[model samples]
Target: MTDLLRLDHVTKLFPVGGFFSRRSMKAVDDVNFALSADKPEIFAIVGESGSGKSTLAKMMLGNEVPSSGQLSFDGTDVAAIRGRAAREAFMAKVQPVFQNPFEAFNPLTKLDEYLFATAHRFLGASNRGAREAAADAALQRVGLSLSEVRGRYSHELSGGQLQRIAVARALIPNPKLIVADEPVSMVDASLRMSIVNLFRELRDELKVSIIYITHDLATAYYISDRVIIMQKGKVIESGDARTVLEHPTQPYSIALKGAVLPPDPAAASAIIRQRQVVAG
Candidate 1:
């Protein structure tokens, strides 16, 4: 299978302190991973805050440039794509679903405008009718339609619905890879699984490779095909989701696994009761 993305000895550093201090912070250091173009899979990046998870996502999305090494998508260097034409071409194949759905879109503009705009921009639909059709079709893929979403303000929709619209906008580009950085963190718990399950559907049915980044292990274990655990900007454990989570090899991975709360209320309650007893 051809590799969709390849990171060769990639590193990103940000200067810190005054000019005289001579110190810098390394966000991502020599990190490497590859996604297959031929085989669509949910490849997850798991880490706590400040682990450079979001930075890695940003680099993959072409929002941030790496300090060293190569980041190639479909054999093209991301850093070299400078012109408007090249950047647009790269954006067509790689899209992003940001962390907060509310913040992703404009409050004043109708949500459907973003969808139609994406279709017009990326799909080359010049006229309003063609753009509308393309927008409706993309929304349909996410179980929403133009009728439901059109002319609606951002506040009118729930977090889950807003996120679905964001995904739909990303799809308008017919992207092969989506870098989702904590896509469901602000969403309600009841709706969280629905969105997570949607990512699985996008991989299996739509054949889109996903770079799913999150701090939640339960959701990661549930949706991901492959998983990489990151700690302080370094990969601690990497393997198939079932194998790694069930039998974690690294100390940090073990600790992360131990921290996961069981879904069953009885088990959770039992643990809570034990904690209460200890506190007394």
Candidate 2:
């Protein structure tokens, strides 16, 4: 079988300097990777701020186009997908869960409205009963029920609940791939694991391939099957998540791993003291 998604020598450039200036900066530089349609796994794109991870997510979601190379999904070129019908068809197969759940929905809108609308649009759940059933099923997959969110507003729920709703909304389409960018970054510390663990369930049970974009190496270690570490818009390392993160050879990769604080108090304290000594 062909790959579900393929980015072959993909590159994106942005014009820099003044309006008259011709210089350009590469946001994504010749990145190549593929996800198998036969297997579903959590593929992590790890990087710090301005590392072009978000830019890559945008390109995968069709929100932005690459300046060079090709992006294909399920054997068709993403850049060539034009027109309202084609776009909607593409959206049904690929969905996106954005970074901030607070900004993803409107405070005035009822939560179920979003889910119901998704069902109606993508699932062809034209009747109220059909839409409600479709929405309820998707909500259940994320550990939510229709009664829990039917009339609630964004402000009425915790960040974790709202983010789960966002994931549930993405699921209503039964997408082949989900591109989630910094999903748990805005949630509370107590609830971060809930969202991270939910992604694992999404892959294992639903067989949905996910491109998880995050700066949190700890959570990436906990959930990802494979990881690609990016720096200055380039992939410096790629391999099995455990192998690359636990025994990274590159200086930058090692530094990133060292940045994670150990769970044990004494070990963490010693690491902090070592850093303090280095600074002195």
Candidate 3:
């Protein structure tokens, strides 16, 4: 199976402070990964704050350029994709589900607008009827209906609903790859599973590869096939999901696995002892 997307030694840096005394902040440090088109799987990027997971995502989306290295989609250089047509072509194949569902849509506008816009703009659906049909079809894919979501404000919908709608909008273009950044973090506990499960369905049913960026290890463990642990703009640990989480080789990975809050005190105690052993 050929790779759909590839990141080769990618790095991104930002300048800070005064002009003369400017300091460079390395957001992404020589990270590398590949997603196979034939293998539709959830690839998890797990990391704490300031770990460059988000930066790497932005670079992947072509929202930010890499300071060094390359990002290619289907063998074409992502950095070279410029202008409206080129970007639209790239966007049709790769879409994003932002961290906050509330912010992803406009508060003042109707939720359906984003979906309809994506249909018209990306899917080339002409006229109101065609656009509406495409929008409704997308909604159905995310376990939602147009009637339920049409003309609704961002505040009116629950976190889970909003996230699902966001997912639906991203699906409007029938993207091959979806970059979701901490998608379910803001949703209520009960709703978190629903959204997480949807990602599994998207991979299995829709054949879409997802780049799931999250700090939550429990859900990551549940949904992911392959996982990468990042720390301070570098990949410290990565491998098959369960194996890496069960027996982490890196201290950062162990710490992250330790930080997961268990449901019961007994389970918590067991995890603590395990963490102690791993730390030793």
lDDT of 2 by residue, 70-125 (tens): 99999988999999989998999899998999999998899899999999999899
Q: Residue pairs in steric clash, candidate 3?
A: none
Off by over 4 Å in 1: 269-280
State the local distance difference test value for candidate 3.
0.92
What tens digits encode model 3's per-residue C-alpha lDDT throughout 1-280? 3889999999999998898999999999999989998899999999999999999999989899999999999888899987899889999999999988888878999999888889999978889999999999989998889999888899999999999999999998889999999999999998999999999999999999999999999889999999999999999998899999999999878878877979899988888788689889
What lDDT does each candidate get?
A: 0.91, 0.94, 0.92
lDDT per residue for candidate 1 within 1-280, as digits (tens), equals 3889999888999898997997888898889888888899999999999999999999998989999999999999999998998999999999999899999988999998998889878989999999999999988888899999989999999999999999999999999999999999999988988889899889998999999999999888899999999988788789899899989999999878866779889887876787688799
* Model 3 spans with C-alpha error above 4 angstroms: 269-280
Alpha carbon lDDT at 98, candidate 2: 89
Model 2 CA deviation exceeding 4 Å by range: none
Task: Estimate the lDDT of model 2.
Answer: 0.94
- Residue 162, candidate 3: Cα error in Å is 0.5
- The local lDDT score (0 to 100) that residue 72 gets in candidate 2 is 97
The TM-scores, one per candidate, come to 0.95, 0.97, 0.94
> Judged by TM-score, which candidate is best?
2
TM-score of 1: 0.95
